[model samples]
Target: MNLKEIKLAPFIKLIFIIAIIAYVVLNTDIMGFVSKGISPVLTAFIIAYILDYVVRFFELKMKVPRSLSILISILLFLLILTTIGLFIVPRVVGAVSSLIKAIGNFEFDINALSQLDFDNFYLNEIQQAIVDTVTPLIQKLTNATGTAVLIVVNEVQKITSGLISLVISFAISIYMLGEKRDLLARIKRTLFAYLSDQTANQVLYASRMANKIFKAFFLGKLLDSTIIGVLAYLVFTIFNFEYALLIALIIGLTNMIPYFGPFIGAVPAAVITLIANPSSPIDVVWILICILAIQQLDSLVIGPFILGDSVGVSAFWIIVAVTVGGATFGIVGMFMGVPVLVLLKTLIEEDVEKRLAFQGYEGFQSNDIKNKKSRK
Candidate 1:
């Protein structure tokens, strides 16, 4: 074989031995705990990042203790989350419920409309199509309403579970943040003890970049969704639509989808509008125009400004990431899929631009050109 493999038989044996041991460790019951515990670990990581910034600001700028600084940061983060949740979630829930309740009436109302033989057959067809499209949507909304009732009934237990996890995560984050310097010292010590400083630095740097990417992506998109939801609610109220709150909330929440988010959000919103006012042609047109206009504002301005700043992905690449994500994983997958791609893109770009730059590829471009000429 290869000269290097032939010469490094002992090293290869050691690697195999290590790999087998590690594999066993990672596949055992202990690994199940690790897998299940990933959520808290990540939760802690987010908390730590936010706390780290706050601690640095206070400790460096105000000459305060790390403990107080971390507490203040955690409180601030909690406050922000609570304020947004209070303002948005209830209104959204109410709107969704009202929309669900109104759908049955709207459907029955449409059946009555068929009695009139409205001047044009086209109008009749349009009304029938609208009813057909909305029927399934109404069913889905009803199902969601049932699920919401279940949640409300089990709210205590759910809240308890949520609180417990949140507490554990916060504690872990506090530990990490408070002892960040010491933790770094231990990591550096381990790396120097077992490996080289240069490799360790590279690993650490890559990890920081990955962490930053996740932080910016999740938080920035959350902000974007909140803005859109609130704006839609306001607009809907202004229009004096009966289910303004509900449809707007749905649009906002669903707006979290990447490239196709707007269309997904608009469907139910438009359907709700059309069904609710099938006779009022002008109202239906206006609702369509308004939903499209809001989506346009998001795609053109708000989305680009917020998500674009954090993810730093171009519109073209956003479409690519979203399309691949949707094709692979459906809706929920699409939500997380783009961020995963961005992380991978970041790593590949970094690796190529950094460590792999010196790897030889001298004739690759010219060889391709020569091959094309020969084929011609």
Candidate 2:
């Protein structure tokens, strides 16, 4: 092919995009620059994205003016922050301190083990092993607690230093929300300027899909987890469970992680309860039972009601997403993994169907598969 006759525009654009991505990924200086410069903007976008729903609720449902809706959403957001800072943080900190202290003061009763009538050699060895492990285990626990506290202190310092950025982000988010329509229009205009109609439309569709998935997953999960946490706190307080606030916070935060979250929160909470009230092992049992009931309620009723088909993936894929995402990017990854997977699944399915149709191939549609399953 003649060099001038060959269309190099698409290839050039693809190379430019790949190069930018590679540079962002592989260059430390560029990564640092992005973190410093773009972090606030990104944070602001996330805040505005979340608040947009509340803004819409006020504007559309309550018939409030758009500006007034934005103002109300901002106030509500600030009120929630104030409440968490004033009431929840201190209690959670105190609970952590108390838990550490309790762990330190806990003593394994080897004498109780000795009181058992089992005289087998294996039993004796097992008892001896337990005796040997207790002291080191306590020491390790103390060290881990200290490390965790130090990490929290460091994180607090980082947050304190980033307060200016937080303020700026808040301001940016407000502006973004206020001019959302114009901002979106500008973005769409830019996309169409550089891309063909088909490509631009695909990009727009993907953006919409991503927005829908993220909004539904994050907002629904947040509401569900908050309710679960409140219910847990009430149950714990009524039953006089130890570290109710702390355990409830743990449960709520972990509940943001799908599938494995309840178990993760329950394990640590149960361990703490058991350690704190060794004399009354029955209290641990009750705590476990209560947590189980709460999880059951969430999974059966609350989660389904709120999340619905937001994550249109199977349990197996969700588990895979959570595991892979967590392994790759920690807690944030775990929380985001399902929706990301769902979006990717959707886009891939659409592309595959398009290609199959172009090739005149007959294939099973997802809706048809679902209909068949329902009929069965």
Candidate 3:
């Protein structure tokens, strides 16, 4: 190994790798080609990951055969999904239809605004101007909402267009689940072959911890959102709110996001309420209050029970993750950002602690460390 050869060889390899990446990224056709193949692969990975947790529970806790457990878990997942679809879809469709019709004929009753502040001339003028300006905008907004929903529904129905791809993904997931043990063993063996025992163990531990954090975030968020959604639906329906199903569905889904989720869901819902009941804008205020109450309950009670320290990151970092995620990858990015941040945070913390311990610089000592010091 000549000195020049050793140094230049690495640079040459790096340049080659960068060139290939640049070509792939810059060439739209090639990028699209790559993207077309990525969806199924991603979907399968997601399916396998979610099912792995269920399969493990059945195998370890119930002593079920792994194969049988996988089957049962998959079947149960499908059943729950189908049940939810059957229940929520029809009601959402009906609500959307009613909402569209109502909005199509929506009128901002200036008289109602006047009644709220009869003696205030400036307020009345502003109210009149708002009524004139906002009425048409409201019509356009509702019409657009209805059109967007219909387009999404159509796209969903057209999912059968990619049925073959979906089936392939499911098959891939099934194979992964079935061979998970062998797959994991092979991966560990390869890791050990490539690295020291300590390095390989650290890698495995980090991988497992990442998987655990992701599972906790995704599963807990899903359950928490579902509960919130159900509660929102119940409360809205009990209050006889128009478009209850639609609003609740929005609230439920948005609740998956961290701090801003409730407000994100509530604003549109309040708008819908006001538009649906222009005669009494008080409904909008009441709905806002209702959302506040629900959010309080979620933050104080439901969220803790379901999501308890899932990310283990503080609020500021979570917000940063969410913002960056949303900016980069849209909604899915926003949904996943926190868990990814959690994994990164965990890895960093582990590495820092290890380095600190190796240097014999422990400020905040653990119980074991304190005990050892006392013994010494």
Candidates' RMSD to native: 7.9, 5.6, 7.2
Q: Tens digit of lDDT per residue, candidate 3, span 51-158?
A: 888999999999999989999998987898688679978788777777767766777765455457647788878877887777677667756756766776887797
Regions of model 1 farther than 4 Å from truth: 1-38, 50-68, 81-93, 96-100, 103-157, 191-198, 243-248, 271-285, 307-310, 326-332, 350-376
Backbone clashes in model 3, listed as residue pairs: none
Q: TM-score, each model?
A: 0.67, 0.83, 0.79
How many steric overlaps are in each model, in order? 1, 0, 0
Give the Å error, residue 253, model 1.
3.4
lDDT of all the models against the reference?
Answer: 0.71, 0.83, 0.80
TM-score, ranked from best to worst: 2, 3, 1
lDDT (tens digit, per residue) of candidate 2 on 292-318:
999999999999888877777778889
Best by TM-score: 2
lDDT value, candidate 2, whole model: 0.83
Predictions ranked by lDDT, top down? 2, 3, 1
